[model samples]
Target: MGDWFQTIVDVQATPQEAETLAADVRSWLISSGIVSAEPTHCVLGADVGHPPGPRAETAVDPSGWSVPWHDGLAITVGRTVFDAGQGDPMAVTCPHCSTTTHLADERFELKYEVWEPFREVVRGWDEGDDIVIACPACTQPVEPTSWRWTDDYFVLAYLGFTFWNWPPLRPQFVDDLARHLADHRTVLLEGKL
Candidate 1:
């Protein structure tokens, strides 16, 4: 079986505030015994991350397994494009008009004509550009990040916390974390690699 990961992304944090927020969150997590204070090579892509602490169980659902399986918390602080690891988003829904744009056809073939603009915007967003796309139906310009994706597939943000192979987190735990984040909006993305 492949590895699984769950990421909690701060959708509202600015690039300049990400590092500070990350530091604060790390401190809180450590003091709360959710993760260890010392960093180690416990994450997939990152060189080091905070391993699960003694009270790691407090963060996950009571019914789920509590064992520390693979890795730990990896905080990314920069303009980044966070997506589901393996598959592409099938469609995007415009926030303004509630219009849906399909990126793939009935046979799962990519619709290049519809997807090219979004692809470019995603690239620009990753590179720190404030790119916006015009909705085909509404003809209104909107931030790509504001559009809803299939299965909540993508998020453009400056801060994200990726937990590798951890149990499903508790909703209360996520809410508490968001509170520590100055009430910023967060998105939970889960995928397998």
Candidate 2:
């Protein structure tokens, strides 16, 4: 199985905007010294995978995915996540009983207050939305604001960036990125490998 621990942040923007944002992020990485000078560039095309470097694999594969980016230490920007795998939702705290349990945990039974949002983006999340889950311990409804739905990544619509082997991005980073892109509607998505 592919074993990439990806941290993806989806930006809400158009294709043109996404391209611009990607370039800006690349420059930021270089200027911030997170990436060294003379980093290489590569086009991710075919072979159903993006190899870890500038050279593209010529082997024929059917994943039908392609994009371009600077190798390593920079975020990969794209319109769609493309072949993103699902993971368990971030752990949630039961507000009714103050019991903490993962959303995917069997011990915590979830009752979707509004199932539509969860259905539309089963593997996606946004911080602005209210948490719609019940507490497992007390079997009572919990205030959405009292629960925390934290995770490694979140998937937003319109645009996205993939960070490989990087530190978890802070809230300020997302806010700043959206500010730079002029797209405040962003979300995080965790893609399982």
Candidate 3:
């Protein structure tokens, strides 16, 4: 199910906030009996504008309530973030569709790399399955119900084979390589630690 995890990924929001939300969700999952118990581990992989800070603060209402309203199957194909020693494309044009998307200059200084393997495994997506993504980075024409933009990353929820893209949070995506990750922390209150 590598493709499943890769495709079901999300991004945006302060890393601390995202991690807290993930933890809350995990708690809910355990309390609801959907999972075994207080998740020993909860992982939330996301695309962010920067690497997570050592001491990022979380908000009071960090839990994202929008999930119930949207499908989780979404993908964001941002311009590849390359390393300092590499030559990254100034702009990328989708070979299959000839659609082009631009990248900002800061992304050049940032060490960005196309983690397709991570995307593939986390979202469980493989090629040739009608993977609907955005035009250049993640150009997949999907219903609004399928995807959306949260803070900075694209939040998507897919049903079976259908794919979706989330709307941008406020300002349009600032750059191509801007991505972040939120790792989950588990706490046991009842059973299954």
* Candidates' C-alpha lDDT: 0.88, 0.44, 0.27
Give each model's clash number. 0, 4, 46
In model 1, where is the ten-residue run with the lowest total lDDT? 61-70
C-alpha lDDT of residue 25 in model 3: 41
User: Residues 1-193, candidate 3, lDDT per residue (tens digit)?
Assistant: 1111212233333333544444454444334432334212122233321211221111112245343212222223332211112233344344345554443255454223443322332243333232444443555454322332222132322211111122222211111112222332111111010
Give TM per candidate.
0.93, 0.42, 0.23
Better of 1 and 3 by TM-score: 1
Candidate order by decreasing lDDT: 1, 2, 3
Q: For residues 54-85, what per-residue lDDT tens digits would candidate 2 score against the true structure?
A: 22121112143343323343345443333345
Show where candidate 3 strays beyond 4 Å.
1-7, 38-193
* lDDT of residue 168 for candidate 2: 42
Instruction: For each candidate in turn, give its C-alpha RMSD to the true structure in angstroms.
Output: 1.7, 10.5, 17.8
- The digit string of per-residue lDDT tens for model 1 on 1-193 reads 7778889999999878999999999999999999999999998889999999999889986475655475799999998888889877799889899999999999888899999998888889877787897998999998967888887788888999998889898889999989888999999999989
Candidate 2 lDDT: 0.44
- Model 2 spans > 4 angstroms off: 1-8, 40-71, 82-158, 190-192
